[model samples]
Target: MIKACALLLLAFNCCAAEIEGLSAIGVGGIPMARQEAIQDALMQASLWNGAKVEASSSVENGRVSELQRVFPVQILDRYKLLREWREGSFYHVMIETDPKPDPVPAEKIAASAPAEVLATPVAAAAQGVLAKPVPVRECAQSDFAYRKKLLLAHFQLQNPADANDLSHFQDGLQQELSRMLSASDHYLPQRTVNEAAFNLQPGFYDPVLQPERVRELARRYGTQFVVGGVIRDIGAYGEQYGLAWGSDIRSGERKISASIPMLKLNGWMPAVAELGLKIKPSSRRFEADVYVFDGASGALLKQQRFADSATGDVIQGRDYIFGSRRFYETDFGKMVEQQLEQMVAGVDQALACQAFAARISRVDKDRIFIDAGSTARITKGDKLQLFRVSGSNQLVPAVNGDSSMSLGTPEALLSAVTITQVQPLFAIAILESGSIRPEVGDYVRFSMKESR
Candidate 1:
């Protein structure tokens, strides 16, 4: 059996042979074992039609060793997202691509989709294919070279539990989370974001205020996702095990136990007996809800609640900066650290499949420029796909509560280019294919599929 592979693992279990060519259908994305192994029969039939007829094979010891071809370019720049859907944890994206630039028809969208239309056919179709995808899917493995950009914004308190130390936790939240994701080596971290920059109050992402502001945040801060958090419960709550006998916890706490007088009369035996009458000790816990928003649209994408407990110094005050050495040394500090790990995982999972896109700042004859460079981990000779924004609009979920948002822009792939030169803030490239000349304000997207 022979398989056609892209630069990374684009094979997606799509194996091809001499007689059996690679199918236009690319089946990929593994969320769980049992369900992923069982591909949806309805989705399996999706196919791609391309203009290609090249397959080279090598045989070693009477066995086919390798099969190489360029049906789909080494970079997926030539591909187009055709369809996407999810069943349980399994999600699929069907795309059409070619060596030549192919244009998908523009779907008529106003400045924003009406909030009353839950799942507009146009919005449903544009889901991840055209708009920057949300609740993104991830590849099985991690990619180390490039780090996806993330902007950590404000976090709010659910209730004023007299935890004055947490009032300023927003700054600590930004600083610590920035440190956490940056340590993970999977995100380009920005932590100084505040409500002033986005022109909103705290928890704007909570109601999903002006969605266009996310695109502006992306443009100005160079981030793809905006994150916020809400502190729910961060106090001590008693545990009730009751020896697993289903005993009444309140009764246990109120049970009559031997006192010091009884201990003296019972010759020190009563004090020992009183220990069994005591209830379980209270444990300090930290509970918070993390909110993720698409930087392209202010739409809330994912909200995850995380809770963990520590044994000592779990509560913060006006003086404590979260994730500091003094704070981290305490039981509460460790619990917060653990929570940050999970938080980073959520952001990573949501963005792993979305392609990294950079805007074209200028386009000169035989020379094209993009706004990303070495800091983005892009190297020389890397190939990227060019696209022009046909137009854009705003999109909101239906009044009935559809959970999707759209940037409402249709794009046309222009050409593939190899990075010719690099700088700290920008990169230069020359077109390798296609006839549509690129202009300023166009976009170049990295073709590698694995953003983990």
Candidate 2:
């Protein structure tokens, strides 16, 4: 797994001040909501100021132990808190920042404004998850023993010229993504059958994953995140005559690029385009959108498009079955594989800081059953923090505005649980601290990453 450094790279900044309005939950036991809102805004400001996220852990068996982040003092100093207000249980802050936006690699932060991301004390984000999470994690723990889950729902086609030839993309991409992620150390993937996977859709045109759709997916699949994609085009590149390949081959694969937008996270203002890959004249082109939805909130964490073109062996008709040896032998297969690699890399970065979560299936006496077990890599004797949310655990819009979103459910901590028995689909646990009753829909989460 790649350690994704979520550095906010600034572009050609004319030393212009930017306005960022961010929010967080102040309700319940969230500690400092006002500060969190301010910090959140600063994070964005730093991103635009070429800030990189990093982590340092000194706590071990012997020495005075702790996990911490060292922020870029200069970036923090540049942001001025314009104003702050509260609505219902949410705390909102509007900050004005001066940024010179540039996308610098995580390794290159030192030459510029060097600020490391400060991890919290309780390991609330995830165990040793150094990357900034793409989703909100108020009830998170840093536990390495468990890996976050991904459910590949469905891959769609955008009116293909050779629909049958590109048929493999509909489900093949899902299977292939599942295979790649399953082999990864950071994430576990839930395989989908056609009957269960076909119906799920992220959205069309500008996509927005609905909350209810996410809940249903979580209920049926028991996954932490749901991922889907739309194959926008796999055809010819406009009217330019191919330099080499047959007209039929060019017609099969779709057209894309020249001005392709990259990742477009919905909540944030302007869409982020890391690279605008261009397609060559008269070449077989492939382009698609990949989406990652949080099971907890159904919020679209990642929406990225990858475009690549090849001049040869782009399969026409159903010349070869997808993923078959013959298909892989073609240049088009290699192109698709390259995009899949990018897609998986994106998924890793999106989910890296997310905590491992399992739904409480049943509560009998002092024993608790969770939907994830050995199949999801559960081990006996593991301890997890338990919590009960006021409502369904999802991030929803705050009462008054859309500028900020809050975890709809104000989670109240319950007693910790010790895993005593493990199965493939379920695990049995008992309260480690108190003797109180928990509910079926409550959650059990690892606070930090732990050694396997």
Candidate 3:
């Protein structure tokens, strides 16, 4: 069997093309033959199912110009480039390999297999032999991991003052901060929550003393960062309400005075309130600004602010305060969760946008060529949009006999062409629309309407 296999391989090699300066296995180096094969393989990949290729050449510029003229036919794994060499007297070729396709998700394979096979450990153990183990390493403590202490100091208004109400409000704030931290993926360890302290002041606004208070707490708690803010009265108004005892009883009218308290706080409170208001039945208004600073230098790294309102009802014995004055339990808690989620989403979007920007690069074409073959990441049937970045005067041509005669202006549109082949740098697209034939050096962009 071995002798037969060897003989068959020998026969195959003998029949293979013997192009000069080309490698057959792609190991010796990329030559015309191997490059052609790689380009063909790229076209075969599902990424370019329907694509076309065009050809053109330039004389004045060097190899770089020719390369620019050549379009990317397919996307290969960056690691696939193995060898490169000169082809004939004028052409330089590069050979590459296809990237390994992503493995089937474990869930998919398990779902397809027999239930008994999936349930038993035998199959899993057998598969383990073929799979790579994830590496585990111990984590080291760093400056980024160091935890800081946060203190929120604010003044509470005592109109029919209740110490228990203030306590409940403080508890609500702490709970909200905890939820926000838990929801975030980047939260650091060693976060110490200091007990919220409320002071009695006559005025609606109290000086925000949390910064200094945080420093004091940090010394006592051995923490790195501090957070604080205040609560003040923004405005107040009166609402009229009617209470009826029975159908025969005339409704008794009464006016209730409502006061708006401004809670100027640091860190997560205001943010949670802002997000919570998006939910229905919340009416607690708050504005919070949070900042992270260096432990020693107090240099700020991250800062953000959020504002929102909460409204609903508060029960007072037999009577209920229903108009916009709600106790901080129900609405406040819900708001905190919503705010945390929004903050996390905002951070994720910003990071993703940055990453996306880094991956896309721009290239200009000097000549026109049909993108062809399976290796070029082109498909057998794909359409592309072509555009030219020419000046308005160049775009509009003068009448042949009358230079003064105005012709219609040119506009950008999608190419009416099917892709036949895809190459490394370029693709071959057949014109499907317009009477004018696209020439070399015409700028083209592609959109995948039917991606594989």
Candidate 4:
């Protein structure tokens, strides 16, 4: 028995190699169970080697059932057949399988049937039908080395006072950039910290000095973009007055007298700037706006502003003065940090949008087809809704209802279509609804229900 099994295996391999486009056809008197088992085994084998199986169903009663199955196999210019016979069974079982050709050469699959036919064809007969396997390309790590370098530059943060403090910001930026790049599948070069230019001076609004300084720093650091902005105090004041008049009629002279002494006005100042303050208690606060720019071109890419009340005591003889203390300990510093975080988030969003646009352009669908044996991602026996835009002229009521209005109406309807074959670019489906027939270039959408 062992020797016979080995011989059978050898025979199977030889037969499989020699056969081209062998389709399994179950004749009369074959049990459904046996046929199904053979089909399943063939499908498994095809899928295991990246091949595809196309099967047709037997006709029942007087109606033709639109049922077909395709395996995960991909053929590349080769085909095979498998046949099994039971010594006692009356019918011989034959299976036909084909190797998918590369780049799936296109041929018209939906040819019209002959005028006279004994029964409806279960599947469309096309010349050289094949399924191509999805290709997986291995990308070399060196291809992304440039991206790693770019990412490194953006991840590093610099401040003048503490060279080592830049690392803290760098760590934060690295986490942010890492998450963004991972989600986007993008990479950039690693950025090294510029120890000489790590300065984040607050409340310093020297536009002339700052712009050149930032540009120079960016060039030295080998960065294409640099983001820098200033925080300032903007203040305003206003006043309102009320008038009172007193009239006196003395000695029937009808004399009226009005006197205006002084009217004091009061209003709230929106914001104030205070320097060097700890996080204490105060009613005054300020607003901070941070802007990011392209390092090379000095283009304003993004900006965000936040408002927070000062929380500390005021200095003597000064109006709304927040006393000098540790700058980092002050609420102003905290606000700056908050603004920085928001700026980073905005930059990340911009990067994501750029990546998404690039990815989407690669996969925009141009056309779709529905028929039995049409290649698609849909499974066998699944229903899809077919739709197309229809234009018609209709009479609608005018705005005043005095005159009739003729308008062109554009509408769409869903027709039930069942999937027969799912291929890479198109799906083969049968129209379930006799009333609606889908034409080429019509939209095709999937639906689970017969009517929707």
Off by over 4 Å in 1: 1-145, 160-162, 166-168, 196-206, 236-282, 317-319, 394-408, 433-435, 449-452
Ranked by TM-score, the better of candidates 2 and 4 is 2
Residues 242-294, candidate 1: write the lDDT tens digits.
Answer: 33222333311334344456555787464454443434434677788877776
lDDT-superior candidate, 1 or 4: 1
Instruction: Estimate the TM-score of every prediction.
Output: 0.55, 0.59, 0.28, 0.22
Collision count of model 3: 77
Per-prediction backbone clash count: 4, 29, 77, 45
Tens digit of lDDT per residue, candidate 4, span 356-378? 10000011232235321222224
Tens digits of per-residue lDDT, candidate 2, 1-452, equal 22223333333342556555445552212224554565566666655555334444453456554344434313333455677777777777777753333444433443333223323323323233443433322112222356666788767666555355654756677777888887776577876665232233445465444556665786688788888777788775444423232232322343332333333444462333322332333457788888777776656676788898886556545656676667767778888788888988888767765768888989888789998888778889777768876655344566764422333445676766778999988899988554568888888876543222
- Residue range 137-242, candidate 3, lDDT tens digits: 1111111111112322232333323222233444344444544543443232133343433223556343222223333444453333333323322111223234
Question: By TM-score, how accurate is candidate 2?
Answer: 0.59
**Over 4 Å off, model 2:** 1-144, 193-204, 238-282, 317-319, 392-395, 398-408
How far in Å is the alpha carbon of 152 misplaced in model 2?
Answer: 0.8
Residue 167 displacement (Å), model 1: 8.0
The global Cα lDDT (0 to 1) of model 1 is 0.55
Error of 1 at 361 (Å): 2.7
Poorly placed runs, candidate 4 (over 4 Å): 1-215, 234-281, 284-286, 310-337, 350-452
